[model samples]
Target: MSSFCLSKLDHPDLAWLAADRAVAADDDPTRTAAATIAVAQALRALGHHHLALTAALAAADPADDDTVRGTLHLQAGLAAAEHGDRRNAHDLLDHAAALADRHTGDTDPHHTGFGAAAVQTARSLAAHRLGDTAEAILRHEHVIRSDGWRRLPPEHRAAHLVDATRAYLDTGRPSRAGRALLDADRTAPAEVRSRPVGRTLLTEIIRGGPAAADVARLATVVGLTR
Candidate 1:
């Protein structure tokens, strides 16, 4: 269900289904935390920032395992950023970073990227949301070039690159955005094609006027043929 929702982000109904299942299996903190984070991300994609934050907060468990704590805090921070609460977002993200550093750094558990790189990516996204475009770009660039990036799961790696695409878009660099999106798509078409942000970024690139051949090719690959 999560895969379907993630791959077909144009369809929010699927996300709703995944969110419900995640909430239903609430007996396990690890499962609950991961699901809640996924729900929060889906809610964010659906433009329900408040609901997303609420969902992410539900993932919190001060006594849970390191992965759960770090994942929940990261999700909460991301949703907080989307909710326009920069201070809370930074605090939560910083906490998440500390937890991740003490745990596994940047590793994927339950297919959710939770750790140092995830914290940094969330921080970059928060920075972008809060209008610190240059910082977002720089942070994202470093992540993209690091060994950590190479170690990330394909979809996870793609998601971070797509975030970088937003930084470029903010700075009026359609060509750069185009390249970044294409790079992500090359890594994981399911991640890029199924993501709301991916679709929107591609739309923006298309609207920004003549994209390069590689970008155009990626648009077709991702089914953004319009």
Candidate 2:
């Protein structure tokens, strides 16, 4: 999953190359499907949203594993949302939710991280990407209220918080965004200090003026000074 990790690190071009190598090395249907997840992620990172959606959808068909299939649907849903296909995005998310219902607690078979909570978080992210800030914030609040929230991996929770930060910022809630970023840092310091998305959001919050003390400290920690 080097490709997937690379994409998460914002190295889309390297991720794409790694994904290609993964696909070339694996011919197994399930393994190929797993690699396709990385492919879709890299494609999305590169702004090839439509192609990412198509690749995820195609990969889902051959994915016999529930976790892999569900994860593909989530990827497809996010790509569709980024591509501005609202209906398709919602449809794919709903389909992923249905698949998630079959599984019990948060399972990470194939490292897909597909489960009820993951689907819920994906909904929040899709909503945010679709310009539905109200829905995004609502879903995000619902996610944190659920028992599955704490059950998620620190990285997953932290990344979702970063996305939630964007939703809060969109609604002109800089303090809420600041709180989210703080939560993200508390959850996984690297998520805020290392990831480009988190760093950019933190910069935005700082530039908006009058940040909280903790936020200002975090800015300094991340080498971002006002």
User: Best candidate, TM-score-wise?
Assistant: 2
Per-residue lDDT of model 1, residues 6-98, tens digit only: 535666657766776867867776777766766766777677877877776666763366776677787778778877898988898988988
**How many backbone clashes does every candidate have?**
1, 0
Clashing pairs in model 1, backbone N/Cα/C closer than 3 A? 105-116
lDDT of 2 by residue, 1-226 (tens): 6786788788999999999888779888888888898898899999999999999889889878888999999999999999889999999999999998987754566877778889999999998888898999999999999977887788889999999999999999999999999999999988889889999999999989899999999999889984
Compared with the true structure, the alpha-carbon lDDT of candidate 2 equals 0.90
User: Cα lDDT of model 1 overall?
Assistant: 0.76
Candidate 2 Cα misplacement greater than 4 A, ranges = 105-107
After superposition, candidate 1 runs with Cα above 4 Å error? 1-8, 105-109, 194-199, 220-226
TM-score of 2: 0.95
Give the TM-score of each candidate. Answer: 0.84, 0.95
